[model samples]
Target: MSVADIKKHLYKAIEEIDDEAFLQAVYTIISSKMGPGATYELSADQLQILEDRREKYLKGEGKSYTWDEVKDRIRKKDGL
Candidate 1:
């Protein structure tokens, strides 16, 4: 039902597994973006840095571009 519940279920299931195929299946689930959410809390300094990044980004001073323009520029710069 909840993420924690799913995680407990997953761990229990994984602990019972012996097959390579089963392990791969669990690996696929774990690596998926929609699967488990990362469990971490930032330090105060890290949070401040993330907030500073947001402030900088909102100022349009990060890297201005449309998708293709940015891609092409990067390609040219790298002589790709």
Candidate 2:
């Protein structure tokens, strides 16, 4: 279906929703989507690890592989 059709169906469904708690939850979800993109809450240690790996990659110290090489290795291991 088209976007307009989906919106019409959503509006009708929303109107029929009468539970206050459910409505509040749905409102919170829709509002979150309408605002800036969703965010991730990462721990300090996890963030540090990611930053360290990125730095190594930028410095050309990280191991890399081509797509074909990766597929060949997977195929070999799987005996495909």
lDDT per model vs. reference:
0.83, 0.90
Cα lDDT, model 1, residue 54: 84
What tens-digit string does per-residue lDDT give for candidate 1 at 1-80?
99999989988988988999979876776678555556356899999988888888899767557999999999999999
- Reference-based TM-score of each model: 0.35, 0.48
Per model, state how many residue pairs clash: 0, 0
State in Å the error of residue 57, model 1.
36
- Per-residue lDDT over 1-80 for candidate 2, one digit per residue giving the tens place of the 0 to 100 score: 99999999989999998999999998788878876744456899999999999999999998888999999999999998
Please state the error at residue 25 of candidate 2 in Å.
Answer: 3.3
Candidate 2 ranges beyond 4 A from true positions: 4-41
